[model samples]
Target: MVETADLTNHFLIAMPQLTDPNFSQTVTYICEHSREGALGIVINRPLDLRLREILAHMDLEADDAAVAELPVYLGGPVQTDRGFIVHPGTERWESTMEVTDGISVTSSRDILGAIARGRGPQRMLVALGYAGWASGQLEREIAENAWLSGPADPEILFELPHGARWSAAAARLGVDLTLISGQAGHG
Candidate 1:
């Protein structure tokens, strides 16, 4: 039997053929992956909401002038009301998952409090929700050509403009997504 490698710290780029409204033309950063299942956060697809709005809603005080305008992303389709913070740092938060040596995901409000105090991770993306898959589900989707996996680039996640993330992630594999057909082909 062939061993399946874990995809932790990888990026999953949606193929053009993927018409799922939740994931079409999106780039997802895999924070955890195992034989049991997988969990990731979409790096693109910002909603109309802003970080300030969320802060206000949660009654968490923040540096309003600095973070108010920051775009809040729609991480994925699952648990849309929950918040997730993908950031770079080793500092442990209340409910944090160390995704890689330099990156992590925090789901607790304490991190938000730290962020509000301007003491959080240097680079971070605040998002709501996350993508998830059952055992064997992601592997099957990859086999079906629904997504292309590649190494995760922190620059793409934290530095690039949100609209460019999808193509940028695909470009990492030398793929020009625009030229790809939406129809599936079998050899």
Candidate 2:
């Protein structure tokens, strides 16, 4: 059986024919991997939300002078009300996951406060919610060819424009999304 550890720091690119309303054209970055299950955040789906808006709702001080000009992404279906920050390695915070060589996810409010104060990582993705799978579920799906896994690219996760993330991730595998077929096949 495949293990989550084997898929850590990887990208789960949706298959061409993926029709799930929540996952179509999604690019996910795996964070925690264990025998129990795995957790990741979708790096490409935006929900018309922003950091300032979220902070305002939370009643957390919004430092307009410092917040970067970036939009928050819908990480996944879980806990859409919460916040998660994926950023560069140079910045440090509590409850962080080094998703890749230079990319990390921080769940602590401290990092958010820093970002709001203009003292956070130079590059970052603020995600609300995350994608997850129970033990063996993700492996079973992979066996069914529901996804293609590849190493996560830091720049692709943090530097590219939000709308381009899906295509950019597929490009790493030499795939043109338009050529993909959502229908899964079985022999």
Candidate 3:
């Protein structure tokens, strides 16, 4: 059966055994999930690219140096050419989609322009591409203990350092991934 359970605004913590190079040790924030499929941005994988570099490429200059210095993340393996911004805001933008009450994902250049002008939301994660799962693919992965799902924590997503996110996310659900064996027991 396809999962009807909405994972919007949830965090999928990769289990210790989930050695997929794309998702292992990552904390993915689910932005949209439906009967058809799911889309998410991996929160903890920082790409070497900086926002300043992206801005320069787009010919958008930032008013604030720190904002320009923000790290751009490797969101996932899909659509690596695109950019996505995850932020907490209620304002609608040209391509903004509300993942929850205050959480949103915007791909429009307008938002990036605002960010460049120091008018963007205070907290944001800029990522390239996103994690996607075909219908029932995530459910099957969960059933196989490839991931642990729990409420998404804004602080973990926006405030914490990238290296700390995985354990911190799993700890929110009281799981110590290191304590779990990578090899599963066969019945």
Candidate 4:
């Protein structure tokens, strides 16, 4: 067995050869990682739905005039109906998991209510579902060269355009993924 370091608060940039429709060209934030397993959210794949539509569906009142048109992201391929919020705030909400020193994930409706009322965290990314891996699964994938990971940068998460995140995440490792060949070579 190979020992693997926990990748919590890291970003997994999919290699071009990964080719998985759900993760291709994606940048996923590792929220939790351990010997038990790992879980993450894809930060770059926004869904067609808007925060207003979701608020309406949940019967939450929102100050429409105050609510910006926030696009919800497809966190991953798992639990497609569950919602998760990656935000940077000190206020703790129900079902919230502190991913790192300054970042957290909240899956409670109250946070959504706060957002609707324009009183939520200052920066947030609303997502549905998440990517998951069983024990040893992620490490195996890493060994297979399916991903390149680097320290998580909140700026990339909150400031970069969704379409540019994958490349930006890879750049953190000084890697230009575009230059990586799809075929593996043996020396």
Query: TM-scores across all candidates?
Result: 0.94, 0.88, 0.96, 0.95
lDDT of 4 by residue, 143-178 (tens): 989999889999999879998999888988899988
> 53-171, model 3: which lDDT tens digit per residue?
99999999999999999999999999999999999989878999988888999999999999999889999999999999998999888888888999999999999999999999989
Error of 1 at 172 (Å): 1.4
Report the alpha-carbon TM-score of model 2 versus the true structure: 0.88
User: How well does model 3 score by local distance difference test?
Assistant: 0.93
TM-score-better candidate, 1 vs 2: 1
Each model's C-alpha lDDT? 0.90, 0.81, 0.93, 0.90
Q: Over the stretch 1-187, how does candidate 1's per-residue lDDT look in tens digits? A: 2235788999999999899999999999999998888999999999998888888887976775667678899999999999999999899999999998899999999988888888887678999999999888999899888999999999999999999999999998999999999765898
Worst 10 residues of 3 by lDDT: 1-10
Q: After superposition, how far is residue 65 of candidate 2 from its true place, in Å?
A: 5.7
Report the lDDT tens digits of candidate 2 across residue range 1-187: 7643478888999886677888888999988777788899999998787778777665665555346446889999999877899887846688776666677789988887777776778777889999998989899888877788888888888888878888889899898878776565797
lDDT of candidate 3 at residue 12, scale 0 to 100? 94
How far residue 153's Cα lies from its native spot in candidate 3, in Å, is: 0.6
- Candidate 1 lowest-lDDT run of ten: 1-10
Off by more than 4 A, model 2:
2-5, 60-68, 182-187
